[model samples]
Target chain A: EAGVTQFPSHSVIEKGQTVTLRCDPISGHDNLYWYRRVMGKEIKFLLHFVKESKQDESGMPNNRFLAERTGGTYSTLKVQPAELEDSGVYFCASSQVGLFRPTYGYTFGSGTRLTVV
Target chain B: QQQVKQSPQSLIVQKGGISIINCAYENTAFDYFPWYQQFPGKGPALLIAIRPDVSEKKEGRFTISFNKSAKQFSLHIMDSQPGDSATYFCAASIGGKLIFGQGTELSVKP
Candidate 1:
């Protein structure tokens, strides 16, 4: 089985620009999560998806950020008119079903570093 | 308000010593507590985790001590090595959503 994979590894965009980050989770993993960590801060949850349906999005910072998982497969996060504060690494994680599943842990991608200059 | 609080933003320990990181949570509903380790430019990986029902769980050199009454938990790294140096984060999970603490940067010297 392959691990979670993230694209570009790093993304740089000017302020107010738009950037879309992609995460391809492990096959058969039904739970996908998105988190971000700004410089000097701990990683924070952004949202979660269960089989293409959003299970929780309370962590979404604002309306400027949108996440989607189509067909219960790979997921994408789009930041429109991104701001300076949005500069950080966006991490995507995937896990098997069941509460406290994947006893080992959720497999996390290397993450896409988004820098809004 | 921050749901979780971790202490000693940074720590240093000699090789073969012990590295302890502490965390406290405010949400009583949080039943799952886990610690993560992240190297530079990498995503965090689970180190050890414990549920409120158990007071402790050990995995090789890593151990997690949980205190449900105090709503606190800690990670203990025994025989610390240079490879153990990284940023450690304590998190509480409720309903599958994880709330992380501020994080602690641990440096194990050779």
Candidate 2:
């Protein structure tokens, strides 16, 4: 089976522009999550999806960031009016649910490096 | 509010030596601990993990020593090789969400 996959491995855009990142989770996985790491910073959670509904979104940095999972499949994270501080790597991860704390571990994509100039 | 803290921003170990990285967590509710390894230009991958019920877990040349009482854990690489160089992160899980520590960059020189 294939691992989690992310598109546009690297994206470069101007400040105030918009960029959309896509993630395809593993097959039959109902749990997907988004995380970001600014330069010289630890990876921080952005949001989480349990199928089509959001399980948690407390980690979203601001109103400019929006995430959606359609049909309980792939997910997209959009950054609108991107700021210089938005330059970083975005990673998507997935794991199965109904386990005892997801012990099987999460499979992460290679991540998309977003550079806002 | 960083829930997890890792030590030694960077480390240099000679090949065939032992490499150790330490992490401490502040959340008592966290029951699952995992270590992630990331190569350049790649997302972090799960290296190994341990639950509070176990004090130690080992896989191949990698080992995780978990101390639930002190709320701390560490990754140990025995007979480290140059290919083992990478950035490592320690994370604690509440439910299924992970709280990651600041990463430690390890370099095993040949």
Best by DockQ: 1
Backbone clashes in model 2, listed as residue pairs: none
A14-113 in candidate 1: lDDT tens per residue? Answer: 9999999999999988999999988888789999999999999999999999999999999999999899999988999998877854383588899999
Worst 10 residues of 2 chain A by lDDT: A96-105
- Local distance difference test, per candidate? 0.90, 0.92
**Interface Cα RMSD, each model:** 1.4, 1.5
* Candidate 1, residue A23: lDDT: 96
Best model number under lDDT: 2
Computed on C-alphas against the true complex, the DockQ of each candidate is 0.71, 0.70
User: What DockQ class does candidate 2 belong to?
Assistant: medium
Query: Which pairs of residues collide in model 1?
Result: none
lDDT of 2 by residue, B73-96 (tens): 999999999999999999988768
Across residues B68-107, which tens digit of lDDT does each residue of candidate 1 receive? Answer: 8888889999999999999999998887778899899999
TM-scores of all candidate predictions against the true structure? 0.96, 0.97
For candidate 2, the per-residue lDDT at A36 reads: 97
Q: Which segments of candidate 2 are over 4 A away from where they belong? A: A100-105
